[model samples]
Target: MAPAQSGAVLGLSLSLLLGACRIQAVKLSSDNLTPTVMEFQSVELSCIIKSTKTPNPRIEWKKIRNDETTYVYFDDEVTGAFENRADLLNRASLMIKNATRTDTATYRCEVVAKSDEKTIDEIKIVLTVQVKPVVPRCIVPKSVPVGSAAALYCDEKEGFPNPTYRWYWNSEPLPEESKSHPKYVNSSFKVDPKSGTLTFTSVVKADTGVYYCIATNQAGSAKCEGHSMEVYDLNIAAIVGGVIVVVLILALIIMGLCFAYRKGYFANSKPSTSYKTPAKPDCVNYLRTEDEGDFRHKSSFVI
Candidate 1:
C-alpha cells in the first residue's frame, strides 16, 4: 500500500476509536444482589457504576414491596421513612442504619447519564431484615383426667420467617416424638413445631408437669412463661355405684306407683245414694153436677 493510503486508514481507525470511547454505555452492578441483616442493625447495599461517560450521573433509589414502589432516595436526599436513617455511600451504594422488618424489600438503584450512549441503568437488590420472635402465649390445661386426651398450644405473631416452636416440660426440652425418647416412654404425645401444638393421646399421671414453649427464628428466640398441668385418676367405680343407686331409686318409685294403682288409692269415688223426689203435675181437671131443678150444684176435683 502507498504511504498516503496507509495514513488515511490510520486516521479512520483513530476516529472510530475516539467515537467508541465517547459513546461509552452506562452500566450498573452490585457486589451482592441479595443481603440479609438482622433487625435494628446496619446494612450496606452495594451499587456500582461499571461504565459511564457522564461524570455527574443522577442517582435515585426506590423500594418495592407487595407490588408497591416508593422512593427511598430522590433529589439527592433520603426521603420518607429513611430520611434520617439512610444515606448514600460512594455516591452510588445505599447505607441504612437501624434497619427494621419493614425495610425488608427489593431496592433498586437507578442512574441516569444523559451524556452516555445508554442513558439509564439500574440494579435491583433484595434486602431482608429478620425480626426476632416475641414472647409467645401458651395455653395449658390446669387439670386433665387420666386416660383422656389433652392439648397444649403456643403461638406468637411478631417473628419474621415464622418462628418454629419447642416445648419444655419441667424445664426439660421435650422431643418431637414422645416414643422416641426413653424419658417420655410412659407419655403418649406428639409435638408440632410449626403449629406449636402438643397433644397427648392418653394422659397419664406421669405426664403432669410444668410446661413452657419457645419460639425461635434466624434472628433470635423468645419463650413463654411456664404453666402447671396436673393429671388425675378418674373414679370409675364410684361413678358406676352412683349410676346403680340412681337406677334403683327410679325403680322403687315406679313400683310404688304400680302398687298404688292396684290397691285403688287413686281411683275415682262413688256418688252418694240420697233420693230426689218427683215433681207434681202442672194441670188438673174439674167436674160439676146439678142434683135437681131447685138450683143446687155439687163440685168434685178430678184426679
Candidate 2:
C-alpha cells in the first residue's frame, strides 16, 4: 500500500474512534416524568440509563419542594424520611414503599460516570401523593326565627389539594343558585364552596330541614352527620301582649311607691329630747357640832 494512503486510513480511524466516544458518553432519561399515587401506597420513579461507558456510575436523588432542595438518596443509601421506606431499583430508579403527601414534589436524578467522555447527566421527575379527606367539622344552627339570617359552616384539614364544600338539605344536594332549582326556590341563601360557608339571607319556615355538609378533593370525599334546624314564625300578637303586661306591672309598682310617699308611710320620725342628771361629789361629808356653839366641820374621806 502507498504511504500516503496508509496515513489517510489512520486519520479516518482516529476520527471514528472519537465519534464513538462522544456517542457513548454518560446520558440519563426517565420512563415517566410524572407519577401519581395515593397516600400510603407504593410508587416508583423511573430513572433509566440511556447510554453510559462507566460500569458503576454514581447515582444521587434530590427532592425539590417549596423552592427548597434536600437529598433523598446519597452515598449509595436512602436518607431523611425515606431511609426506611425507600430503596433504589435497577441501581438508578427510586422506589418508595409507603408514599406520603409530604413526598409530593419535584425529584432530580443525577449520574456521574467519570470514565465517560461526558462525566455527568441528570433528569427530573415529578411525584404527586394524593391524600383522602377525613370527616369535616360542620356547624348548623339548631333554631332560627323566621325572616332572620343564619349561617352554616363546614371545614376539613387533612386532604391534599384543599377540598371544596357541598351542602345537603334533607338528604338532597343544594344547588349553588337557589332560584335555578325549583326545590330550593323557597330558600334565600348563598353557598360559598371555597370557604365552606352556607349563608341564609332571610330564613323562612320552608328552610327548616336536616342539613349535612361534604368536603371533597381529587383523592376522596367525606361528610358530617346530619343536624336538624328549625325555623319558626314570630308571634307578633303574643309578643306585644307580653310587652304590655310588663309595662303595666312596672307602672303599678311606681304608683304604689308614690302613694306610700304621699301618705307619710316612708317619712322620717321626729327626734325626742334627752335629759342627763348631774354627777355627785366623790368623797365629802359635812358635820354640825352643837356642843361647840354652832360649829360646822367639813371632812374628806376615801370610801
Candidate 3:
C-alpha cells in the first residue's frame, strides 16, 4: 500500500511541473499600443522574463503587426523590412530605432531554454507611434460691418511629419484657387507644411460662418473648428432688434394689468356670513303685476 501511494503522489507532482513549463516567461508591459508617424523618433517595447534563472539562452523578438505577413524574428537574425532598425536591448527589452508610422505594430518575445526540450516560452508586446500635424484656427476682429471684408489669421502648432494644410468654408471644402486678398498670405492661402501655418486674405460675408482647418500626413489626419464669424448688417439688424424689445415690453404690461384686476376682485373679496329675513308671502299676488311691468322696462334698458 505504501509503494502504491508513493507512485500516485509522484505522478501528481510531475503533472504540476509540466503545467509550469507550459506557461511562458515573457509578458509585455501593455497591450494596446498606438503611435504616430514622423522622422527621428524612437519607440521602445518592454517585456518581463518570469523565470528566476539568468543567462536566458535563446531570446527572440518578432514583429507580428500586419494581418497578412509576419516581419522580423530576432532568433533568425534576419530583419525583414525592419532590418537594422530593430534591436534587442538585452534579453528583456526591444527597441526600434528611428520609428516611423509604418513601424507601428504588435511585437512578441520568445525565450527558449535547454531545461525543457521542445518546450517554448513566449509573450507579446504592442508599440504605438504618434505623428503630430499642423492645425489652424481663425482669429480676427470681434465684429465686422456688412459688405466689408474681415481678416482671418491661422496659426498651427506642433505636429509630426510636418502636416499639410487644407482650408474649408463651413463643411464644404475649399478649392486651391489663387486670388489676392488682404489678410495673411496672398489670396491663394499660404501653407507651409514645415511651419504648419495657414493665412486667409480678405474674408467676404459669404465666409461669415464656421470654418474648418484640415491637417493630414502619412501618420493620420486631424481637423479643428475655427472661430465663428458674423458680418453684421447694422441698419436692418438694429431695426429688428428694437422691434423685438418693444413687443416684449408691451406683452409684459398687458399681462400685469390682467393679473392685478383678478387679484383685487376675485381673491381679495370676502363672502357674506350674516343671514337675511325671509320675504312675506302675503305681498306675492299684489307685487306680481308690478314685478311684470318692472321686468319689461329692465329688458328695454338692457337692449
lDDT, candidates in the order shown: 0.93, 0.91, 0.59
Better of 2 and 3 by lDDT: 2
Q: Write the per-residue lDDT of candidate 3 for residues 1-303, one digit (tens) a residue.
A: 699999999999999996776543332343324433345577666655555333455767777665744646556574787788866664556667887756667777776665544445666666656666544554545566665544455455555445676666667655544343434233334444444444444444554666666777666677776656665656988899999999999999999989988878546557679888987454233224743652223322433
Structure candidate 1, residue pairs in collision: none
lDDT of 1 by residue, 1-303 (tens): 999999999999999997787568888989999999999999999999988889999999999999999999999999999999999998799999999999999999999999998899999999999999999999999999999999999999999979999999999999999999998999999999999999999999999999999999999999999999999988999999999999999999999999999999999999889887965344533334485444322334423
Candidate 2 clash pair list: none
For candidate 1, give the lDDT of residue 284: 37
Candidate 3, residue 190: lDDT: 43
TM-scores for all candidates: the values are 0.74, 0.80, 0.38
Which residue runs does candidate 3 get wrong by more than 4 Å?
1-39, 52-56, 76-78, 134-303
Q: For model 1, how many clashes?
A: 0
Q: Write the per-residue lDDT of candidate 2 for residues 1-303, one digit (tens) a residue.
A: 999999999999999997797767988888899998999999999999888879899999999999999999999989998999999998799999999899999999999998887899999999999999899999999999999999999989999888999999999999876888887788798889988999999999999999999999999999999999999989999999999999999999999999999999999999998888966454544455766654333354434
The best-first sequence of candidates by TM-score reads: 2, 1, 3
State, as a TM-score between 0 and 1, how close model 3 is to the true structure: 0.38
